[model samples]
Target: MPHLLPDTGPQRTLAASNFTYTVGSGLFLTAGVLYFTQAVHLPAAQVGLGLGIAGFFSLAVGIAVGRLADTRGARGVYATTLVIQALATACFIGADSFWPFVLAVCTATAAKAAGLAARSPLIRHYGGDRPQEFRGYLRAVTNVGISLGALLAGWIVQVGTLTAYQLLIIGNAIAFAASAAILVLLPPVEPEPAVDSPRWIALRDRPYLVLTVLDGVMAIQFKVLTVAIPLWIVEATTAPPWLISGTMLLNTVLVIALQVRAGRNVDSPVAGAGAYRRSGMAFLLSCALVSLSAGTPAWAAGTLLLTAVLIHTIGELWHSAAGFEVSFGLAPKHATGQYLGVFGLGAGLAEALGPALLISACITWGRPGWYVVGALFAVTGLAAPLAVRWAQRRQQAGKGHTASRQPPRRICQTSPP
Candidate 1:
């Protein structure tokens, strides 16, 4: 037999997906810093509060957008949303007052939410029944975008001009427009059936719900590693900023290289379950590595922190790929957007809470904060295998019950439970 090659169509779709993610990540990288700078003129707490408000809006609107994507075609919705987001990014370039800043952020947030909702479903549609590999590829592309954006933003900031920052935002807008164009070039996606679909029914699926909860919990660690860890490094260690950047660089590189490999052959529920189990263990290890930073000497802490960060990044890759696989697998075909949207809520909540929670943990527990986070990580990690088993059992039981009710002649063969 001839060696089978991956379908050309799906490969093309993956390229398009990567383009979209790159544009989105670049835009976020540019806009986030600029928004923070504008907020910094205000009281410190107020700045934090403003960001929190924006996050709340993003989460709320993201769920609504997901529902809309299910009703409308993901391609059309995504294209429209990207245009709006680009305009919003432009608006931020000229924003001066607090109210204008708020407006800009809200507009951008809504656009992002819509884009994310559409993007997730589109990936699923393009991937057909095997979403894990596609999602992994998407993430790998997204990580590349993030890395590039970070580099660009750092350079812009180092240039030390508000105009330079504005230029970055302009570049981001261009990227978005370019991404929208690329998406338009792709084949149109068909809308899935929406008949008899229950609104927010995804929220009711127990196993999926558990997975989302665990994702949310794990997100706390991610947030800390990205945000709080840097701050800790600056405060407690003699490490230079370059080291921190290096850690992130290494993370992005590893993700780009390994995600597709890790995601390959993960097409079934059993494989997805296995992925989750491994991801959970990785998370536990990451937590432990990060927690060990407290014991290192100040001179050596940077190297230790960097090592820990590398480990954490690996865990992130595993967990993210697994989470996407399981969640997308469990979602109903017709309600893919809504289900992903609902699932995304946990992440949004975590992003909103992670910074404050981590800071508070540090303040309350002192040096042991790292250990507390580690413990949480281990607990959640260990819970994943149990969760996967439970989900499989539940699905099997449901199948058995359904089979028993059907007439022998009328019974339709389906994919395994």
Candidate 2:
């Protein structure tokens, strides 16, 4: 916990703000679907469909808003997103039907995506010499905040009343508002100086785009525990129901403890690529282990499942750390917000599509699907180095071109002599 503390003022402020926001996010993540289905009486299918649609539309918002942050100012833009998120969240209480629910969820999702992009420049600016490492620290802080929020939310869920759910929603909105207020304490991060490049430089970077696609593919692993594991435990294995929460608790604790430490070792794009490779292999092995648990005795099944989760969490750490390094390191300093926003599209896509994919590939298809999904991650990890190399080469070439375009220095002649 001492290691999680920031050494400087801006870092401290950002950490505080992030912790506050994620606490609210944790509440929503834990109980938001239930609020729609149980409280509002919306069908479960409608909730999932609305969230999917919202997630899809929200992808573009990040890029647009992020560009605005780079051109205008990140601090104000980011704060505005939080205010918008607060409003949108409050509106959830009023969404009693499908369309209203969709509208409210979409607005909030878009704002959340935009806020992430807008915050990138500030992270780069105040992150000192090792912004990626600092990002890891914030992630650790985020897990702590979310865990706290989830615990509070567990109480709300246990109450099992519409009013209790509404209070949770309201509490989440207030947290968003409070988080924005906390950010006011930080010194403002100025806008990036204007450049003469194309308006959508990140979109135009083909190598970067390719890397984004790969990252998006790999991002499916995030849905494994959230969507697939619980279903698998119930349908395929003889493990107890309590293990669902237990596994999540274990994952959360490990992330909070080791994410920063794992990130420190992955300092460059090459190392990041290597980390990805290792992460993919870990995912593969974990998948195999999980598959073996399906037809086993109760004791063996629980053991295998727990072992798989431990391996998967290690892969998660590596994947997250590698992502931070590659995303930040490859981006141009002046266009950090735009690039990071573009990078976020991958995760956004994953959020929208990964659950369905995982369900089909892993659960529906049964145990063999696990190996197939694991191999996909392994292949994606193996491809990352090649994509990164392509991006690096292009960056170098672009720099060379810029240098060549500079006018030659005027040679002064001694004509007077």
Q: Best lDDT goes to which candidate?
A: 2
Evaluated at residue 163, the lDDT of candidate 2 is 97
TM-score of each: 0.86, 0.99
10 residues in a row with least lDDT, candidate 1:
1-10
For residue 155, what is the lDDT in candidate 1? Answer: 78
Give the per-residue lDDT of model 2 (tens digit) for 237-274: 99998899888988999999999999998999989999
Candidate 2 all-Cα RMSD: 0.9
Give the per-residue lDDT of model 1 (tens digit) for 148-178.
7767776776775766766777787777777
Distance (Å) between predicted and true CA of 121, model 2? Answer: 0.6
Task: Give the Cα error of residue 129 in candidate 1, in Å.
Answer: 5.0
Candidate 2 has its poorest 10 consecutive residues by lDDT at 188-197
Reference-based lDDT, residue 296, model 2: 88
Displacement of residue 50 (Cα, Å) in model 1 is 2.1
Candidate 1: C-alpha lDDT: 0.70
